[model samples]
Target: MPTALDRPTERPADARGRVAELRAVRAQAVAGPSARATEAQHAKGKLTARERIELLVDPGSFHEVEQLRRHRATGFGLEAKRPYTDGVITGWGMVEGRTVFVYAHDFRIFGALRKAYGGAYIVMESQSIGADLTYAWPTNETAVMGAEGAANVTFRRQIANAEDPEAARAHMVKEYKSELMHPYYAAERGLVDDVIDPAGTREVLIKSLAMLRTKHADLPPRKHGNQPQ
Candidate 1:
């Protein structure tokens, strides 16, 4: 099963020259888009995807798979932009002694308890999407939607009726975050397990993985059904 760090299952056919091809691709995968991209992430106080993975797993334990896969999307502006790895890192690594398959990408975070805004985008990779264990950083935005949209839509009538519409909107936006979207609201209510520091994420994950290693389950077989593409 795919975990947070891996989703693609396609692997290239084995052939004589595959080792050389993979070595070249692996070198590219480790570098990311460019040195400038690394600078940009550092500018925003964020780690690159691979760096985060390395931090979470045992040293020298991650064995990345499917690094040569590409997307098949044909239309829109996507046709000509088929980059390798599909902009995600998918593979497995040891967490303590457990072998965990993982993937990394820009995930939809779980909601920040009460969101008061526009149509909420269900994050495709959040706990709401059935993640077994979820974690958040102290600085994560952790909202279902932006505070501005929440205030504008939820308090539309109040803003329009107020003598100072802009002031009303501003107050409502602040109220929305403070009253409904408090940073620790999710952890308080069990929506998320905890709020953690970025530097401590690896240690926390190691502990959590150890705790979960004893849990097991079996899914009942289900009838196949046709689903829309």
Candidate 2:
């Protein structure tokens, strides 16, 4: 038999102690993001990553993988912000009693994932030639109005000018959303090529592409590249 020194130095008092340790570990896993981050997510009318996983899977069935892993990517200043779980929560869980794997990342906290279908690259390239566009609703009105500090200043002035500040702000938001978000207005202003019905999108795009195939315009040479010594 191995001597005490040859055996493990750290040991739980009993089976119950080991079970308690496991509970603590599980608690940390379930905690997900910081309290402030969780609050911000809820404020945006979105569920937390953990919550999403819970909903996606049957209750009490989520078995998280790499819950305690941390990103080792370091340069400039990224080492200071090494993300836990590498900013992604991946696991296997039961959905309707069927086992399914899940990979969820909070785009708000990290970055977005882009998925494209057939001809999407060409469509996006054509669209990129025009003015940039953004969409917002009352649910995320703050993003629409631009920086909160700047928006507050403008809103304050508008409130001062109006007889009822509260009512005026609400009216302003509605009017702004209506006026700024219409595709027809964007087309008229040459911000977009045109808007077409979803059902006829493929047909319309084929015709547009056929005409654009022969269309050409003088363009400047590319400049960005690795600099020569």
TM for every model, in the order presented, reads: 0.66, 0.40
The sequence of per-residue lDDT tens digits that candidate 1 reaches over residues 160-181 is 9999999999999998778657
Tens-digit lDDT track of model 2 for 84-129: 5666788987655556667666644454332212243223332444
**Each model's number of backbone clashes?**
8, 0
lDDT of 1 at 65: 80
Compared with the true structure, model 2 gives a TM-score of 0.40
Cα lDDT for residue 120, model 2? 37
C-alpha local distance difference test of each model: 0.66, 0.54
In model 1, the Cα lDDT at residue 229 comes to 20
Best by lDDT: 1
